[model samples]
Target: MSTLKNEVTAYLGNSSRIAEDWANYINHQDWTLEETIENLRQMNADEDVMVQVLMLDTMQGISTKSSEKTPDDYTVKYDGYYALNKMLSTFGNSENGSDVCITNSFTNYINGILSIGFAVKVQVTGVDGAREERERNG
Candidate 1:
């Protein structure tokens, strides 16, 4: 009976170690948004994909709101706008690029999804600027 009890204890200990290793491996896996979207596409069909996209976008908005302002905000915003402008010019160039219709569609799609108000919130921190902008715009 003692030998059997010892064997059972050893088995349980090994099982616990295996579970811990599995959890660690899962935690260390690098995940990306594109891979996640592809996985969802494989798992779900039709309207489920749209639902997942909307859910992700909403979660992004919430996560963006949970962060406090840092000094790097301006740098990031400048880089983003600069890259966007470059892309627009490259893709929309009349002489050697795609037509305006495609560019306009892409622009509208980007504008529809991007929250300019959220950008303003992140870039404008002071109470005075926020109040003035609200008063002047609204």
Candidate 2:
């Protein structure tokens, strides 16, 4: 049995056949155990992101705007960020000073007037060392 299959079966208590099946699937996708674990960790980290929507109860507005970018690609020129910048710019301001805007709605929902308050929490991760190492190695 492959080491990966053995490991999977040991951790999941799956039958040998099922373990092999899963290993095959994972291999076919060109995904390693390390990458899978990293992806899972990223997903868990994402869950900690809190999105707040504060507005007057009488106002009928929806904040369906958000931007998500990776460490490698985060800028106004990026499509997601571009859209967010454009939309937020309509309100005469877009400088929240937050690293990631999970989601937000800050304009007029009912009429053409803006009237709402919201909170944006920022979580910053330092990848400079990792990025520098990668670049140096490359």
Candidates in order have lDDT scores of: 0.26, 0.27
lDDT of 1 by residue, 1-138 (tens): 999999967855653443334323322344333333344345333331121111111212111111134422211121234444343334333343112111111111111242211010111112332211100000
Task: Give the winner by TM-score.
Answer: 1
Model 2 lDDT, full chain set: 0.27
Compose the digit string of candidate 2's lDDT tens values, residues 44-95.
3334222122211111112222234233321112123344344334322344
Model 1 per-residue lDDT at 104: 19
- Model 2 RMSD in Å is 19.7
How many backbone clashes does every candidate have? 0, 1
